[model samples]
Target: MIAITEGPINTQAVIDAVQADGAGAINVFIGTVRNQTQAKPVIQLDFEAYDSMAVKKMQEIANQAAERWPIQKVAIVHRKGTLQIGEAAVVIAVSTPHRKASFEACEYIIDTLKQVVPIWKKEKFEDGDVWVAAHP
Candidate 1:
């Protein structure tokens, strides 16, 4: 599953969606807005996306993870628009019959998503803001 939401993400919902009877482990990775970057004091962030491309890219990451690992499920949820420091920006969950597969697939999805997704992040600082490569 994939989505671009304005409100905060539900972590429990993500875990529940990926769990299965045969799965022995579920790995979850959460990305948060940091307080600082490049030595600048960050106050918040504004995330923007080409919604159509973002969703397609997210699904592609999930499909790639599934094919590369022996996993039962994959879920990726990313938030858009304005977000404050410490807010959850993205969540990736993967469940498999073993711990290793779950871990590997979860990491793969996040790595690939960062590289390929069309999400742009504007880092808001006390003095000024700048747009940089996001989710990578």
Candidate 2:
């Protein structure tokens, strides 16, 4: 499953999507909105994405991880629109026969998604807002 939604991300659903009978390990990574950036208090965050391209890039990242590891299944769900502090912005889950592969693949998917996915994040500070990198 690869999706770009404007609502809250269901982290458990992402994990469940990757469950496999032969897989012994499932790794999940959740990216959350923080209350501050560089000591500046943040009121909220607004995320925007070229939805179709974002989903395509995410799927490509998943496929690449599958090539590098013995990944049984993978799910990546990212939320756009406004989000408050502590809300999950993204959830990535991967399952593999072994723990190491699951860990590696999960990490790879998130790292690559940040680099390649066409998602923009705007940090809404108390005084102003500034656009930042997707996962910065």
Candidate 3:
């Protein structure tokens, strides 16, 4: 499952969607908005995305993870629009029969998503705002 939402991500829902009977472990990654960046105070963040392309890219990442690891299910949910500090912007859940694969795949999904997904983040600072790169 993959989605780009305008509201806050539902962590519980994402976890429930990726849970399975055969899965022994589920690794979840939550990306939250930070209060500061580059030594500047950030008030909030505005996320924008090419919705259709972002979801497609997320699914591709999930498929790649499934192929490389023994994963049972994957759910990636990313939030758009304005988000305050500490608010969850993205949630990724991956389930597998063992802990290692679940952990690895979950990390892979988030890293790959940031690299490939067509989602842009604008950092709102007290002085000005700028569109920041999705990945460092």
Candidate 4:
């Protein structure tokens, strides 16, 4: 499952999507909106994405991870639009035959998605708002 939605992300659903009888380990990574950044108070966050391109890039990341690891299944879900503190922005789940592969693949998926996906984030602060770079 690879998706971009405006609503809240269901982390359990993501984990469930990647579950398989052959898999022994499932790793999940959740990226959430925090209350502060660089010691600055955060009000909220607004996310925008070239939906089609973002999804394509995300799928590419998943495919690459599968090639690198013995991944049984993978799910990548990202949320767009305004999000309050503690709300999930992204959830990535990976299942593999072993724990090490699951961990490595999950980490690679999130890291690569952040680098390649065309998702823009605007952090709303108490003072103002600024568009942050994909890496930052």
Candidate 5:
């Protein structure tokens, strides 16, 4: 599952989506907005994405994970637009038959998502703001 949301991410909802009866292990990764960065106070953050491309890339990552691991389910949700500190920016939940595959696949999904997903973040600090690479 792949989605682009505009509000706070429901982590439990994501986990629930991926927890299937055959899945013995469920791994979840949540990316939250930090309040401080490099000694600056971050008020909030704004995220943007090429929805078509982002969703496609996320699907690719999920497909790759499915191919590599015996995963039962995969759910990836990314937030777009402004977010307050501590708000979840992204959520990834993967469940498999074993713990090892779940861990490895979960990490791979998030790492690859960061590398390839066309998502941008604007860190809104008290001092100023800066556009940087994907936030995790």
Candidate 6:
């Protein structure tokens, strides 16, 4: 499952989506909004995305991970729009028969998602705001 939403990402729901009977290890990655970037304080983050394209890219990433590893299921949920500090922006869950595969696949999904997903983030700062790469 892959989704680009305008609301908060439910980490538990993501995990539940990937639960499988034969999978023993379920790995999850939750990306949260941080309070600062490069020593500058941030007020909040506003995310925007080409929803359909972003979801397609996420599904592609999941497909690649599944092909590269022995994984049973994959779920990625990314939230857009305004978000406060410490709020979850993305949640990824992967289930596999072994722990190593689960960990590796989960890592690959998040890393690749940041690189290829068509999502943008605006850094709201005290001085001003700028739209930078969504993940940097």
Clashes of each: 0, 0, 0, 0, 0, 0
After TM-score superposition, the amount by which residue 4's alpha carbon in candidate 5 deviates from its true location, in angstroms, is 0.6
lDDT of 1 by residue, 25-85 (tens): 9999999999999788899999988888999999988988888898898889999999998
Candidate 5 lDDT by residue in tens digits, 11-120: 99999999799989999999899988888888999999999999999999999999999999999999999999888999999999999999999999999999999999
- lDDT for 15 (candidate 3): 97
What lDDT score is found at residue 66 in candidate 6?
90
Q: TM-scores of the models, in the given order? A: 0.95, 0.97, 0.97, 0.98, 0.95, 0.96
Candidate 6: residue 15 Cα off by (Å): 0.7
Taking the tens digit of each residue's C-alpha lDDT, what string does model 4 give over 17-130? Answer: 998999999999999999998999999999999999999999999999999999999999999999999999999999999999999999999988988899999999877899
Error of 5 at 113 (Å): 0.6
Clash pairs (backbone) in predicted model 2: none
For model 1, the local distance difference test gives 0.90
* Candidate 4 accuracy as lDDT: 0.95
Q: What digit string (tens of lDDT, one per residue) describes model 3 on residues 94-130?
A: 9999999999999999889989999999999989999
lDDT of each: 0.90, 0.93, 0.95, 0.95, 0.92, 0.94
**What is every candidate's alpha-carbon RMSD to the true fold?**
1.2, 1.2, 0.8, 0.7, 1.6, 1.1
Ordering by lDDT: 4, 3, 6, 2, 5, 1
Q: Supply the TM-score for candidate 5.
A: 0.95
| lDDT tens readout by residue for model 2, 1-136 | 9999988988888889999999999999999999998898999999999999999999899999999999999999999999999999999999999999999999988888998899999999868899996665
Candidate with better lDDT, 1 vs 3: 3
